[model samples]
Target: MRAGVTLRSYASRYWEIYNKISGDNERVVASTFRMGLPEDSELRESLTKKPSEGMWQLMGRIEEYKRLEDDRLQSKSKAPMMNRPRQTGFPFRPRGGLTIQKPTAQMGEVNVTFEEPVHRILDWIKHEPYFRWPNKMGGDPSRRNQNLYCIYHQDKGHTIEQCQVLKDHLGQLVKVGHLKDFVLDPGDRVVG
Candidate 1:
């Protein structure tokens, strides 16, 4: 089989394991493919320079990138976590709070009632580098009413109050003990 076919197969399997893609559009797949490339590879640079290329053009660059990524993943499996050079540029600050909870099978939906309105909470954290605005939700911009604005999406389709992704992210933070002050628990809730 050709390198392009092999690369596509690898990408398909990768998406199956880690995420669900909504469409088979080559541009979306190529974007995902670029993201999965090993950080050290110059292929990422080339891809960034020519992001509008079709899959046929992208395939020519794939075989070497795939080999590099395979080697990186293999070495990662063998290396001790402490020994690897720390990645720079990610703005994540290690919080002095509670360690992450192991996901439980008994986890059920909980309707969190925050001490303050969510919009206010979001406003407080908006400047944090770790906070990421979600991708713009797609729609016919002219047809939809622009009254409701979602800060998370920075779009007009919905209000921040109605944004499920923002709610879910806040819930995760609360569960991890970072946002305990915002949570309205009847009993004692400790902030990490």
Candidate 2:
């Protein structure tokens, strides 16, 4: 039978330690072993370092310090107890239960899929295809924002990105109407 190797755990931060000879250099591809502590899996993943024997002893000190710090914080945050005169009264209960519920069939849900840069003019249903997408490799800045106007308010201060008023109006529509949960809250808070 082969003899077993005993490994000691250092602090959570310094979970991995590398053992090196006096004059020998660390290897390029180092195999990291588990710190043998199942609880500290998070700290084990990080702080991968050169191997050493003293790191484990240092870990014990660090864990001890952390424990002390935690204790001090808990002690400082303790709430004081207060003494007060108490009076007792008979508890009252309702004879019957009443709960209002909406009809499930009335609630309708609609999913709308639209391509980018589809601009809707005065008429809500019919929209003219007006879109300009800039090339990632710095093609042309002129085509960047040909029409930078809010569809709801028609302002230049901000695009649909910073349109809070429009978003709130859409939310109000969802709340008042029988629109489905998905339609009420779109992926992006845009009126369209």
Candidate 3:
């Protein structure tokens, strides 16, 4: 429902109730609160002598819980770079607070892991990356928010998992001892 007068009018007419605080536009505010708010809202349940007080209390509780959760996660997974030096430009940095992993070069070729911790390449992309965050959460779930570039075609929309044209590209890289760190899905491998 739309905010302001439209929603207020709808709520007052439907609920047959008026807002206690706003004597001037009591009907409008009260109606809106009833219609707009969810059925299982804690604020609604905690309505007291002062409706605003109850709402404020509920907000404070929510903030407290959110902050607590943030603290817990921060202590648990803590970012890898807390004590480490910043990453250099020429060579990408290793993530997870682990030692830097160098590619195992064979003859004239260099093999490296495709997986690297996320970096903010652009300002706008931080909020919305080319690769979406993973649906499941874990120790390294932040990688989900990183931009996933399909190395095979350098495309943004589809990962190699769904790219029929570039099927088994990851396996081929693995076969050649390249991107040894990339987790290979068995279904994506090409079968002769």
Candidate 4:
């Protein structure tokens, strides 16, 4: 029985490690055996590097291939398929609709007063998508008020008027001139 002789084992980030066995044993191998040294297998038909090709040229080609593979994988994972529906945008609306009710306890009280009602400004700002939406509240559902709904959170628990987070965001926006139209002078009006 003849024993196989491995001349070398090729290893790189571009492909899997393959053994280069001598012709006297079984495979007449090159450093690029899997790429196309045998020249018989259809899958290995694409000869990416030539034996006469320069070392720098081969490295550059391998780098190009790696970049293309990375881009392909990223796009495949991130892009929504054609069969799926596109996202409906931010500040998701509730399914059954919200019931407008006054809060039992005062919340979202800010030192600044607005020329227009806070709810009206909120309606306009939310439609234009000026601010980032708040994440859902985490707590025991039994303790939360099921009757009230917060548009800011798109969940049932608190009313939009009572959302402290929303009020804080709007206050910051007003200070930054994004909501200057909504601000009312403190001397002109008193906050209840």
Candidate 5:
């Protein structure tokens, strides 16, 4: 017999048995119409003539649909909960400490040599690059002394190396020059 005919025969037999067991009259009617069997046709004659393999295939499709639905429900139940709050600002706080103070002016006496113009020394000190070293290097000298030393060093091409007194106050002065190196008279003024 032809393959189509054989398959149709087997399908019709399965549909008949299924209809008898399931008592689904609508399915039996639909199957009969699909197989070209008239509403009033003889079931035994239809089976003998042609059969169908669609009923079992339809049943397998229904089983797959049920399995997919079960899987979707299981995944939803196993999902993690969402509870974290949204952040609104900076992650760290500002540190607290002493604020920087502005430079203040003070007054003091400075003795400049006769050969050195006082005004020139004063200008040099006023414009000296005070920022080269940290403020902690020297103790606060009176404004006049600070001004004199600044100008004196700048004009004579002297540096921190030539001034032992200033260097001593800065804690960076060594014993490269001694007080006895220069002659001092009774009326001579010394600021140390």
Candidate 6:
């Protein structure tokens, strides 16, 4: 088979995989085939499948096409979007207060101290956005905390009185410069 014929056949197969993975337009596949690099003969032989040289060449071309398409999709997906809303979640506030402990790195060198405990809260929020506060009840298998105070004081269990207490406390904290003002705007509400 001619090089053009072999390339076309390989590209068609590659497009099938790409379409399955990305749900991209078929026109994009056709354009990709037209723009893809030519197959190398030595590399083609290394992937020998039998039948004819044309078949081997097609296989090599398909592999190359898959690589290119995958890269293109990845690059496109990773491009940063402007003015994206920041996600809100529980922040890592040091409960017991933070301490700085300098470590000896080299002779006469001090390592910078970071007192924050490494909690998996940020990672958890990223992976599971809908994750509610873990149940504080001991009976709940997924509960992370068993302390009754933590359970009763949680936002989930907040009664009207508790909510008022919380609101007042937060206001006081803001007034005393202990916490920054992070008032929620109406636009922050999520419509389901």
- Candidate 6 per-residue lDDT, tens place, 1-192, comes to 245433323443343344245443444443444344355543244334332234334344555644544455447768432322222111111122222221111112322111221121112121222222332323443353221111113322222122334334334433444332243333553347
User: Candidate 2, residues 136-182: lDDT per residue as tens digits?
Assistant: 22335465443343333433333333344533433344456522342
lDDT of each: 0.52, 0.29, 0.32, 0.45, 0.30, 0.32
lDDT of 2: 0.29
TM-score, per-candidate, Cα-based: 0.38, 0.21, 0.18, 0.41, 0.17, 0.17
Task: Please say which candidate is ahead in lDDT: 4 or 5.
Answer: 4
Residue 50 lDDT, candidate 1, scale 0-100: 72
CA deviation > 4 Å runs, candidate 2: 1-147, 181-192
Q: Is candidate 4 or candidate 5 better by TM-score?
A: 4
For lDDT, candidate 1 versus 4, the one ahead is 1
Q: Is candidate 2 or candidate 4 better by lDDT?
A: 4
Which pairs clash inside model 5? 8-51, 8-52, 9-51, 11-52, 12-52, 106-143, 125-151
Residue pairs in steric clash, candidate 3? 133-144, 134-144
Model 4, span 1-192: residue lDDT tens: 012211111113111111111222112222343443234532233333343244333434434443444355448668422322221112212233443332222224646666764555665575243565666579886798765555556556776667878777787777667877676665776437
Q: After superposition, how far is residue 98 of candidate 5 from its true place, in Å?
A: 94
Clashing pairs in 2: 10-59, 11-59, 17-51, 18-50, 18-51, 18-52, 19-51, 19-52
**lDDT (10s digit) by residue, model 5, range 94-116:** 12121211111111232222222
Report the Cα RMSD per candidate. Answer: 16.6, 28.3, 19.8, 25.1, 45.7, 22.2
Q: Give candidate 3 misplaced runs (Cα > 4 Å).
A: 1-53, 80-192
lDDT of 5: 0.30
- Which candidate has the top score in TM-score? 4
Which runs in model 1 stand beyond 4 Å of their true positions?
1-107, 187-192
